[model samples]
Target: MPTSAAHVPEPGEGDGPEPWPQGISRRATMRISDVLRALRTEFPHVSHSKLRFLEEQGLIETVRTPAGYRQYSPADVERLRYVLVEQRDHYLPLKVIKDRLAALDTGTETEAPVPRLATADGDAGAASARRRYTVEALAAAGGVDRSLVDGLVEAGVLRPTTGGQLDAHALDVVVLAAGLAEHGIEPRHLRTLRTAADRHVSLVQQVVAPWRSQQTASARAHADTLATEIGELCARLHTVFVRQGVDDLTR
Candidate 1:
């Protein structure tokens, strides 16, 4: 005979729907079943092991009953919803989400709205924007050699904008390099800086990818905000480290 759904053991269960082991109460506090049901309603693929994984990630905390059974609260369920929403829509990693949540908990207002870089009517609008700059215009703006601008593009530091021209942001980087060049600095000298930046970006991406799996608008916003905040933090830490190194050398 085929086994039925009811016959199958629910998580933390035996053969039947008997009281939870150790006489745990199903009221007030939520059981694992309630969490699974709620999460499944919103995110159908949520599994018991995934929930356990979330707990391990420190995304949610559970209370244990006297008999050592895990119990989730209503608040815990809501937090899980928030976390899943962020991960699916925004692709935020667990550590970034946790840090953002911690900041919110401490009443820190560090989140910023994401700016849309591209718009509808995409190619034409983008093209028109790029046509505004010529090679001379970009050289003057960024203060770098026209050849350096080309190198930056080749290096993937600046992307081609509309009309096959460098994008405004990419031009800005060249412009900044140009200013530095007047003071005897060169692009080659800053190659390590670019490499460091790329490494930092990869670190942030790895941290946010799991959260990107749970797509929702709010979650996406949260992930973007968290990424920005964490990136800023990493930059600040790098600055501090450099300063500390200099200080030690001077001392």
Candidate 2:
């Protein structure tokens, strides 16, 4: 039988006890609170419920003690850290992050490995926090007209942030709008793209329906993995189609 990737530790890494508190052992365990404390400085926003929610989402797994309290191993902690960092820094959806990590664990030859950027502290980490952009800033960065930005906001493509500011994600709409302008494709022309995207979302939902229905540990993992694989496959196919079309047009 092929060895499972989850069971394989990274190369040159030992399977010795986690270097947690002096008293803790590989056989020993810690409460969710304790784990939170260990990670709080780096992940200040982390909460007990958030950890449980991540477990529920199938992003990470935890071992249970005899009393049914969660006992996270050092390996599990590392996994959780990786997941959170990816989300905070890259703005990656959980499903994508989960799939990438799983691929790493399994040692699969996938797309170029996700890039890990360096933090200000000289430690390589994900972005520390989300950045919000003002409406003016959004327009400036994307080089789009203010009217177009307003139109997108009205159409629900971009939403106003707290205090009516527009964040970077909201600014992404402006970027899209600017690109469309180059082809005489205004925001209105892109409505079809939005509709198509909605349809694709439904398609993805159907693809993951089986796993979603179960909601078990294994089910979540499978769903995350499947979503990643399908997403990657779709991206690759799209590139191939574009290349083929370009070749045909040139011929």
Candidate 3:
């Protein structure tokens, strides 16, 4: 998941449009091409330029990689769902839609009513609800030592709720680390990943500062969409490079 900072935008930032859901999970990021392809079936007129135009209109915010690539999350996808549905059905312009979104950002209700979803099949789904687990239960499930679990928490990798329960994302991290442990990697060694994430997050934070400063619901979400996608690409690139290194030695 993208490490979304508190989007309390800097003093000078909100002049531009802000973003969408902050702290969105990095799972299931979509490239611009992928998003365009997915929406094509529903809106035959959907185009790359159209999505960019929507972004320019502050309709959506996207994530960017270290080298600059756009990534979209399901929340962003869902928002697109709302926008397109409203446009096609109500014939509302972007200005009208933006106002409704602003109301939502302010935690107020919007007078403009849009259908629940935009997809033709009505498949605007969401991530499953949070599944909580105790530290002991998580350790057992992940097959990692208790000490390792402690190390992960200490290293700021896994965070337990105030009630001492781990959310699904932390649990998933534990499980992955546990599998790596069997191969002689240890939690302490995992700190590099954490460090890398922190540094990249700071860099990405700089890139998205303007959007965050605005502190809009859509702006926050857009920052999240962008961060999560970059994180995904970074992870994939790391894994691919490591595999390539191994393949090279074997060759």
Candidate 4:
């Protein structure tokens, strides 16, 4: 029963769905059963309660008919699809997804991955579930040579688990390094970035240390959210600084 920061009026609670961008419509025509049928082929776990919960979280909007039946429009269905895809493929928290959706509505650049429909085989368009990968598998996934991964491991740019498997985080690093490799940057050049990331993580942890130290569930949850927010802000600030530096170089 998580609440959303976005303001979505409950059925019979408010006037109607909020205004959206051009080309978006909220006219209710399909029933909840129709929506379920539309979604369940790809999202097998969707249910009435799950949809209700997402509505409660303000991820989707539903209109009530004169008989008080909940009705969904095509736009609503697409929005639900986006939510489900993000959750299944990216493991994004609802807060982040909701914020992205709101930004989309306002014509803001969300910087989040675009929501894509699942493939015919029900796979999430090769954006599969997060899992660990061996060095060979990681290299294959990144379309890079195994030696590059080995070099990253040697240079402390990638840390494998004690079981010798690299987690999803390592895969991202490998993929980025592979792209940077096209620019002649090597694994050794990534050490500074890794060191800077560690410093940022330490700073975020220090800021949330008090709440994390509390032995209560609420406190721990608050600390986790605070950590994520602070971490994102730090990353954005870093990006701005880098862009500024690049601008100066170009000038």
- Measured by TM-score, the strongest candidate is 4
Report the backbone clash tally of model 4: 0
Candidate 4 lDDT over 93-187, as tens digits, reads 77998988887766674454444432345555332444679999999988889999999999999998899998777877888888898899999
Reference-based lDDT, each prediction: 0.61, 0.62, 0.65, 0.74
- Write down the RMSD of candidate 1 (Cα, Å): 14.2
Compared with the true structure, the alpha-carbon lDDT of candidate 2 equals 0.62
RMSD of each: 14.2, 7.9, 17.7, 8.1
Residue range with the least summed lDDT across 10 consecutive positions in model 2? 19-28
Between prediction 2 and prediction 4, which has the larger lDDT? 4
Q: How many pairs of residues collide in each model?
A: 21, 2, 14, 0
lDDT of 2 by residue, 168-207 (tens): 4665668767777778876667676567556666777789
Tens-digit lDDT track of model 3 for 141-242: 677778878888887778787888887677678888888888999878888887877787787778778877874556764554455455555666778988
C-alpha lDDT of residue 44 in model 2:
63
Local error of candidate 1 at 11, Å?
Answer: 55
Candidate 3 or 1, higher TM-score? 3
Which 10 successive residues of model 1 have the least lDDT summed?
1-10
Off by over 4 Å in 2: 1-29, 33-68, 73-75, 83-137, 140-143, 154-168, 213-229
